[model samples]
Target: MKKLVLWMVMAPVTGLCLSFMYSPSAVNHPSSKTGKLIISFRNSVDALPLELNKTYINSLQEPFKVTRLKYYISHIELDNTSAVITPDANYFLVNEEAPVSKTITVPFPAGSYHRITFLLGVDSLRNVSGAQSGALDPLNGMFWTWNSGYIMAKLEGRSPASSLPLQQFEFHIGGFQGRDNVLKKISLAFPGGKPFVLKAGKTLTIDINANIQKWFQGPRSISIATHPSCTTPGSLAKQIADNYAEMFSIVSVTD
Candidate 1:
């Protein structure tokens, strides 16, 4: 009877141990329902790929060369047919000269998404949260003083149209308070309104084009010759922000 009781307990324990040892490891499983979403920014001027120091004409018919171009993208959200998924709250500095900085990757779950939305500038929360690290680091030159907040977008270059001494134009746009706010939220839908299907363990890349010309012409016409530099936040900055808010468009999506 003692041996029978011992065997009964040991049999189930042994079976449990064997089951755990033989079960497939979740980490090694091939059916993980997680994927990656890559967002790539392609800067362009008049439909041509942007190259630094290459002369291009703006909508105002002014010839200029971009010496530097940088902007912030944040608050990314993916919208599915049934739900909205915010992968994470992260800020990305897309530098026109930095190839690696142009691509942003986020871990996403398998889903059929139709729309992707993101902020073109850092949100007010992070702006008021004091100094930060990583992409929000002040050393990145995106942030102004803590009181002035961050530079939403910066464009610098030389143009004969510029009235500055060196024929240089600088647009350091920044503001987060009241009417000075230049934060822009941009939403893009897949081509043909088709659903973008992301499979498990696979990666999807979304190519976005930022037309530099849109900065000069959209709702308002900004003449480089007349207003070459806007370094502070005000009505001109807000107008520029409104113009650039329409700069991004979906170019393509690939697996």
Candidate 2:
């Protein structure tokens, strides 16, 4: 059997100290009064939850089954009416097949935040930095090579629309330089523009839905019959990035 290795780096490992930053105009609260923020990623098709190996129809009306799906999320930020709060930079790999990898929890200062923003891919600095341990470890199979950098996001599955042997479609999106850069910054406002307060010593849960159907449409329409493979970064990769950049939306917030 072929080994299935999903791409993208993991989040901060256990025991890493997470620091919170407050804007200059914001009040500095005691570190002891911090709360916890739990961000959850829910992957789905147009109207159904995504399941591995289950056939689903895309915007192009193509039937496909995803065997693996993985992506990186980084540089998370939270914004309130008064100021913007940022957590220490961390790269997280959200894998569809791994439930534990889909949720991220970090300590955050208590505040009423109405907006959240984050990068859809690894930063340029981390791309060029020499091999590191933990999530960024090259052994994870997300890194392409020393020159090509990491694979920001990856999707692999079978589709009857594909022309390749075995009717397989693969998209490994990555690039950190010049015109090929696929890094995208995504910002989403809380539903109804209402802020959710996180009380000290308490936890606030934010559910985010990622619609896979958005990958096939948006700024561009991609058909597996025409373009089934995107192993390297270029214009097509950028288009796909733009499409998936709109895939994330806030679903619900609980405090």
Cα displacement (Å) at residue 93, model 2: 0.3
TM-scores, each model vs. reference: 0.84, 0.83
**Clashing residue pairs found in predicted model 1:** none
CA displacement after TM-score superposition, residue 165 of candidate 2 (Å): 1.7
Global local distance difference test of model 2: 0.82
lDDT of 1 by residue, 44-144 (tens): 99689999999999988899999999999887877832112332237889998789999998767788888888889889888888758888899998888
lDDT tens digits by residue: candidate 2, 1-255: 123222112223222323223224333443766787789999999779999999999989999999999998887777722112332236788989889989987667788888888888889888887866556777767899745598888888999999999999998889989999999988888888788898888888889999988888879998999999998989998899889888998889898
Ten contiguous residues with the weakest lDDT in model 1: 80-89
- Kindly report which residue stretches of model 2 are placed more than 4 angstroms away from their true locations once superposed: 1-30, 80-89
Q: How accurate is candidate 1 locally (lDDT)?
A: 0.86
Residue 88's lDDT within candidate 1 is 27
